[model samples]
Target chain A: MTTASENFDTVGLKQSIEGTFRFRKWRSIAVPFAILGYLIYVFFAFDVAGLASRARPENAAVLLGDFWSYKTHITRDNRSGDVVASVEGERKGTYPAGEGPEWVAMGETTAISLYGDASVQYLPENTAVINVPDFGEITTQVNARAVVLRLPDGKDIPEWMSVSRNRVSIDQGNWRFSMTPARTEVFRYQAGWELFFFTLDSPFYGKSVGELIALAIWEPRVTAEHSNIVAMIDGFWNNKMWRHGDVFWAMGETVLMAFIGTMGAGMIAFPLAFFAASNFAPAVWLRLTCRRLFDFLRGVDGLIWTVILSRAFGPGPMTGSLAILLTDTGTFGKTFSEALENIDNKQVEGIQSTGANMIQRMRFGVIPQVLPLILSQLLYYFESNTRSATVIGALVGGGIGLLLTQAIITQKDWEEVCYYMILVVLTVMIMDTISGWIRKKFIKG
Target chain B: MTAHTVSGTAEYLALVRRRRLYGAILVALFFVLFASGFTVAEDRNAGGFLDGLHRIFDFPKEIFAEAFTNWQNLPRLFVAAIPSLIETLNIAAIATLFGGLLGMALAFLSTRGLALWPRLTPVFRRIMDTMRAVPEIVIALVLIFLLGVGPVPAMIAIAFHTAGALGKLFSEAAENVDLKPVEGLASVGGNWFQRIWFGVMPQVAPNWSSYALLRFEINIRASAILGFVGAGGLGYDLKTALQWGQGKYDQVVAIFAILFLTIMIVDHLSDRARQRLVKGGALV
Candidate 1:
């Protein structure tokens, strides 16, 4: 019923449709299979299976525990027969002789009341006794040669206790007791960071909130030379355990590095961007050269720049800022030039028709269109650079990153690491909010 | 009418003058701040800015001189760096893959209309925010303590941060997607997962892929930096060579060249690919 040409067209259309369907069917199966195969390869490549054995779950437990709690060490030296109670075993947090937490009754016999009915007592002659609620009392003695432990009647050494030739340690849920040849010690685990506000040397060490407020407002000065509030701030700032003042300064330096780096890069890039822009540059070679320069700067990477700059500037905020500046200059140059290239040419033509000079044309036409984009970009970079400065500060040996790395390197200062992490997070979030606000208020508005 | 026109012109002139004056004052204030901040930074630095400016090229020149003399070693050193470079790339690629998957779940959970449980949206958002706020270096360093030095720590750290970063961008894109298809899917008795997978995902996939690509670029840099801090990669090799000082300058040059080339190539390719995706060209 159809002509020959019509029949040919019908046949071609049928074949094309069938081919497309077949291709789609193959693609759908092939893509997923390919991805699955790649993932299988990556699994072996990254050694995901070996990770379980290499991972230290105990270290994770220790880190998590250290983040939220402090331990008080109650020790009696067998040779000197002197008892000392110190927080986290730090000398700065040590309670003075004969002065300890109310939970500990320090006298001829020192009793540490732990959670529940469990308690540890330092008896005379380098001996210690622990009473668990369900179990009978267990005694440990530190002699000249070794530590000897006596278990409760018919009670084998439980899984919580570890015994050796010269040492015996019993780890209860909230309290731990250990006896060695040299000393008998009990570590009472307490929630919250101790000595965070005021050190033991301060007169306001253990004051309640209400009492501190009263002291600050109506009460007589705590220190004769200054008011209660001033003295309180002084003690808090100079607290050897916390070092709040140094931390504050380090945070400021970090912010300063970000600000200087971001704004400086913007200033440097703005002028150079014109030469890189294809629409603005008078000479092709100049445009090409500037573009290459930007690429080279960016390609060098910030890490390399930091290493090189630190070598010159000798590791400080300046080196960090400069490193940020150099890397961002390349970034801003590329982005700004792209922004410039995308501008409406009609506006420039309009200004030119008004007999304006080049500078005037740029100011009246070009800047108006691009200023918002440029500013939003700059503000965004500023916010991110605040975080980068922290990492960069670590490399350059400046800012809060230095303190954080130092704390982390100590392996035992996990609480301080926790504090620094919180501060860094807070600072970054604050910057993000501020920059978002500025972008909304100035650029979008 | 003439008097009204004169007053209007006068008012317009006054407004212009005021705006110009404000701009000038802002510029002045910025310059002042810049100058003062520079002075403070210079004071804190071990070497003054002016003193260090001239000597900046000395180290570079020394390295170049050493490297130039050992030009025969360049190719061998370049070959030596290939494995570390691959490791670095693998870190970035795996992080992007894992982070992109996590970010998708987070975005779906947090975005309105697309959310499975809208009440928990803010909770998921806050979690992402916290994750993003913690820098990769902090996590990497901490994990290094537990896992020891390897690409895995850096990989996990970058992945965590990338998830948070990409989730935010993905959610923003998802928020702007048309809800008609989702409603249509739901009307057919499709479940929550089916509705999102069939309806919202197709619309936002391009934008999400573009973001992931950008994040991939950033993660590359992050992985390298983390490597510099003891994670094993090209950066670790570079550090070791640089520590050896003069004899290993050739290795340093080779590493630098490899890194520079890799970054440039990736940047170029990604830029082109993003343009194609955003411009609605056929994806490769």
Candidate 2:
């Protein structure tokens, strides 16, 4: 009888184990197939096949080029018969009359040098000559009715040059030439940002680092009223092209929004959390009301809060900060209340034994227990909110986000966008490091 | 010994007092900075905070009045917003799915014990860090330029970000997994992929899924925001209706309600799911 019972137990155990393995086997196979099915549906829904035709690879090329290079436009107004050379063709980047980059010689016939020993000369009568080394000179004339083209050595037109009715264009990666009835233009692509340190008007615009250092140490004041060092700083700080002062101010506003928002949320939520915490709540009804209020605030979402606040306060860092404050208050209230509820009862009981009032008991017992958790939460949010502030800043038209969007909208300022992207990333990482350091020193220790 | 104890008490008291003084200074400094920062923010704003604070409810009041008058249209408008809301969710869901898959791969490649190439662990870690640091809006805007205005741009942007963010969380979770199973698998003839898949994945899957669910919540909000910036979803709908102003406010209210309800529902669902996932994780 004992042997038979043991045999029965062994079979039952084996059957149970087999059942579990069968379920696992089914799940392992089913989950992947379900996921694959969903992805296939998304593929069609996103119109990914259509994306191939819609995508602008050319724009990507332009963006990549603009990130590290600047183009100097040498153009002659066909009717006016005058050539002007400007970096990025911005008014602030325009060279003074009769002067241009070293490679560009401004005259009746402007000779602009290009890579590969190529050169473009704007000559008499709405005509331009482009020299392509390893190839021959290609001359194109913009007449009243049509563009007349001549290839070097009677060579067939290369695919790089596209000509249409009354217009002609030559495309080389480093340089480009275009002529219409209105203007004959040659854009000479150069490496690096144009006048990054000093604008066109600054006397110290083209000086090397060694010369700049020498000027700073011993040279006479470049501007009579200010010393060389001051003038140099003035040029850089007030640089119109880069807008260094504005960019720094924007960065400060972004950080400021995060600081005020996170701390302010902590200040407001700390008191409210006590009301919401189940163990600490004076009345059940009060706890429910506080929790519901938090739910409402959180449910409203930061985007909606931002829109509503911007309507009230108008667009700026103030509105952005307020939006962050309201959203974080909800988050902090919920988390802090949970922390309060989880505290050791003995500590609170000990504080109560001293006949301390509610406020004192909370201050002495509850706060001591929860302060580390609260502070760590605040620091984490503060670091994240810095990044959020950029987004909020974009929406409300205030901080680095605004500048980034504006730069992106201009499309030509991809380099500026790249700069702002780097700055934003660096600022976030710095905040992350600082918060980690603080957390280590105070909370962990 | 008594003398030593007495002196030690006094020294400890002195140290405590000095620390309190430093704390007081920090608190005072923080208050000053907060106050000044608010002032600067107010000054830079187009309108004064105090003046605008009183008028805060005016826009909400207008929207409510308009919506009340158009009460009958509310249901239809609500129904109309469902598709865009779905688009928003789709953007988030797709992003979370792709991001989770990429993140899982990246986590395995980066985790110390589970890494396919141990020498290149730091390289993969830095790549993940760089990816995580970039804000979604940056990528969304850049993709908008390349892809034109669509949900695809927002989806891709969010996925790119979700990958990096989830990858970091997943690697951290994977780092703490018991290595015995990994060794057990390797003792047999299991390769690197098999070792990670059979040994490491089961242990970390629960924690990683919980993080991904939380990220899905975040990506939803991100998708909506990206839409407002021209990625095309519920946010774009809200933006257009808001732009129309007075008469169209009923539509705005509908969009807002739909978004709020969706967020609340998602929040509750994900919260419950995470609780279960975590509770079950202990058993696994």
Candidate 3:
């Protein structure tokens, strides 16, 4: 009986060992495959580039057109009496007044009308043409703004000429060109073209037609007059389109939506994160449930949420905002939970020894420690959402993105697109700066 | 000491009062803002709660379900994705390899507060800040105008941005290393070059590699989105497919699947490599 039992026991031991090894091997292979499958599912499920491309052909063509537009030049002393100044007509007003003012060298002058009040510095090499159409009163305000005109002397002539904000009609006969230290009055015409100037603009203002033409032909890069501020705003307003009115309205709504959405998601996520943390919740089932919930939420991208929201809500800011809330909630929950899990557990143990209840222990022990990290992360996400708002806005229709998309498709106006893009960029930069400041002030080491 | 006691109670009380006031103000501000949102124009349905839920759920469902079903057209989607993917990878690869070299050089140059000119450190720091402050996508958009649309512009754009990002990451990693070896190398009359090679790099290599790998992963994901504005990538294909709708859905899905799988595999491999390196060091 002893011999038989010993053989049976050996067999059992061998079988168990073999089974364990096989399981381990399979896991090593299976885990990676599972992960790969999950990733693929997430990616395939969330990919929305196809939607963008339908609008892209025209968008791409517009971009290419913007890049490859005509380079204009005029004869210095031709019969047309010195082609005195040029403007690139856009949705906004003229750039580079007729005579130059004394400022840093803003290379190449491209005359493009900006959507809002803008002060761009032009490079000496190029000329920009700003086309302001007949909007009457609005044109006067723009023309009243100071512009520097370049004269033949390679000197800046500062002047404030009254051209129409939309379009100023000019008569070749009654136009008088004069300059002052503060402002230069150029001829006003009723034929839809007027020139203006400021003294503090650039020295390239009043150069001779030949010199101006040479500059335009040889060196053609116009730097923004306010490079620092312009750089910040260039992303939103510059070379971007507002597809429909929806993108425009949506852009504005996105900011509020992102903030509210983040807050809503964050509130829901915080306690859940604590529960999900391994140190705080030792129970396997609780940990698994929390983790799975987080994965499900975060696994999907915001864009996917947007389409879903659009369908349910019939396309609007509410749809966009709600979509943002759901996705951001999942993401914040996952990140916050990870932070909680990584915290030193000894502090919790210390509080426990003092006979504190769960709430008191969490308040005294966990909150103090995790608050800074959490706040900083939240601020960072807020900054990120400002940009995301623009993108998501494009889908559901409403915001600056809508304006941007429309500009691209309808007008194919690269310059106007550029203007809108700059606005978005500036907004994001401002948000980032604000967030950084708050984080510095409030977050502890 | 018993005869002279220093009481900090008053000071502590004043500090507590100040903090409490600030906290109350913050709480009040939050309520005020939330209240304003409540006054916002309501939807026609008036049942704000259910509408919000439906809107939230359906957006993702419609977008994803459509994208998923459309993923059936594998070949066309692959063609679209492949070029963009290659372009994106090329951008990342070139940026990483070159940026890595440039970052290492900058790390050495600015190691001891501007090696070439101590006065220029602040200037370099400002320049780095400005460069990094503008996101890579923004940079590409600007460059697209100046450089014209093509791979070269995209490459340059990525190169410039990554230089700043990787440089910052590398500098921090280098700065945090143990200085004992550095001092030892210096004591032995080793030159600066030798000190960096023998003293600093050895210790920071693992961290540097880890950071670089992490950056590579991020760059891959970022590059996917660069195509939205003509920078060129799989993102472009994805965008096009989405906009065109219906016929191209399968293609879009296929591209996403490919990219998703690629990312997973790459992430796994990188983690394994990182683990091995970390373990090998611990063993050593």
Candidate 3 Cα outliers beyond 4 Å, as residue runs? A1-265, A282-286, A296-331, A383-441, B1-21, B34-53, B56-87, B105-115, B145-152, B180-194, B263-284
Clashing pairs in 2: none
- Highest DockQ: which candidate? 2
Best-to-worst order by lDDT is 1, 2, 3
TM-score ranking of the models? 1, 2, 3
Angstrom error at residue A70, model 3: 16
- Which candidate number maximizes TM-score? 1
CAPRI level of candidate 2: medium
State the lDDT of candidate 2 residue by residue for B1-284, as single tens digits: 99999999999999999999999999999899999999999999999989999999999999999999999999999999998998899999999999989999999889897888899999998788777778888899998899888889998889988998899999999999999999999999899888888998888878988999999998899899988998888999999999899999999999999999999999888888899899894322
Model 1 stretches astray by more than 4 angstroms: A1-20
lDDT per residue, candidate 1, A14-106, as tens digits? Answer: 999999889889997998898789778778877878888888989998899999998999888878888999988889999999989889999
Instruction: State, as a TM-score between 0 and 1, how close model 1 is to the true structure.
Output: 0.96
Tens-digit lDDT track of model 3 for B15-79:
89999899999988987875464334125112354656545544345545776665455566676
Looking at candidate 2 chain B, the ten consecutive residues that score lowest on lDDT are B275-284
Residue A240 CA displacement from its true place in model 1, Å: 1.4
Taken over the whole model, the C-alpha lDDT of each candidate is: 0.91, 0.90, 0.56
- Each prediction's Cα RMSD? 2.0, 2.3, 15.5
